[model samples]
Target: MAMSRNLTLLFYVTLLLIVLTTNQAESLSSQLSQPQSQSGHSMYGATQGSLNPQACGPRCTMRCSATAYKKPCLFFCNKCCAKCLCVPPGTFGNKQLCPCYNNWKTKRGGPKCP
Candidate 1:
């Protein structure tokens, strides 16, 4: 009877270990797959390259603006006129002009530039 009990306890322990290990693996995988955040935008990583232009959000428009200090700046436009401009995270720019861009670079590995 004692031997049986011991064997049963060992079985339960093995089962518990398997369950714990599986749970841990799943959690780790989920973390790896999840997108990192940068300047209120999702940042996959440096290896993933720049974010798509469409992903930049509705208020912003990314283009090669002559008025922008940076070659490519996120322009806030209203109809025909551009109200504001901001550089991407990886690119360099001033605090006043590229607030979001600066934030993205500091937080994420690279800017959400397209």
Candidate 2:
């Protein structure tokens, strides 16, 4: 009888552990699936990010390297990357990889992502 009682207690403990584990996993996965907000960059304006933001600095630096207008190029490239979360390959063309970067324009209808 005592062994049976111990077994039942162990079973309840195991079930509780399983329930807690499942709930924690579900919570983590839901957080992962949810989009996170970016803060402290309103000066660049609001745009949707579709790629890993951690990679933006290197990608933007590469994109802006060849330009004589490094400051504005870096600024805009980082801005576009923050919004589109993508940067075209190489220091030149290949904007086709990111349509958001490719199609964004200036106030007078110039390419905004450059």
Candidate 3:
């Protein structure tokens, strides 16, 4: 009886480990299969691939006008715009149009875009 109980416990533990490991592997594979950028856009290719151009205009305009850092600004703006779908107007000091964009944060927890 003691031996049987020990065997049953071991079997259950082994089964549980297998199930947990399989779940973890599936999760990791799903994450790997999807290509994403820090700015929350799917990294399809160059030129902000697969984004709707219409939604990018406001953020692009704002970022273009606000920063001397053209390349990085554009990249950040496009990413924010892709997610938020709207950009606050003017060169600086207005973010009411898209609350989500305005509130976005970088990985380091700072403001994501200008």
TM-score per candidate, in order?
0.34, 0.56, 0.47
Q: How high is the CA lDDT of each candidate model? A: 0.43, 0.77, 0.67
Candidate 2 ranges with C-alpha deviation above 4 Å: 1-50
Instruction: State the lDDT of candidate 2 residue by residue for 1-114, as single tens digits.
Output: 999999999999999999999999998886565344475332121223445788788878888899999999999998989889877778878777677898999999999998
Candidate 3 clashing pairs?
A: none
Q: For model 1, what is the error of residue 53's alpha carbon versus the real structure, in angstroms, after optimal superposition?
A: 27
**Clashing residue pairs in candidate 2, if any?**
none
Cα lDDT tens digits for candidate 3, 1-114: 999999999999999999999999998876666556797554322222234667576547655875778787778877887776555556664665456777899889988866
Q: Pick by lDDT: which candidate is best?
A: 2
- What is the lDDT, from 0 to 100, of the residue 18 in candidate 2? 100
In model 2, the Cα lDDT at residue 9 comes to 100
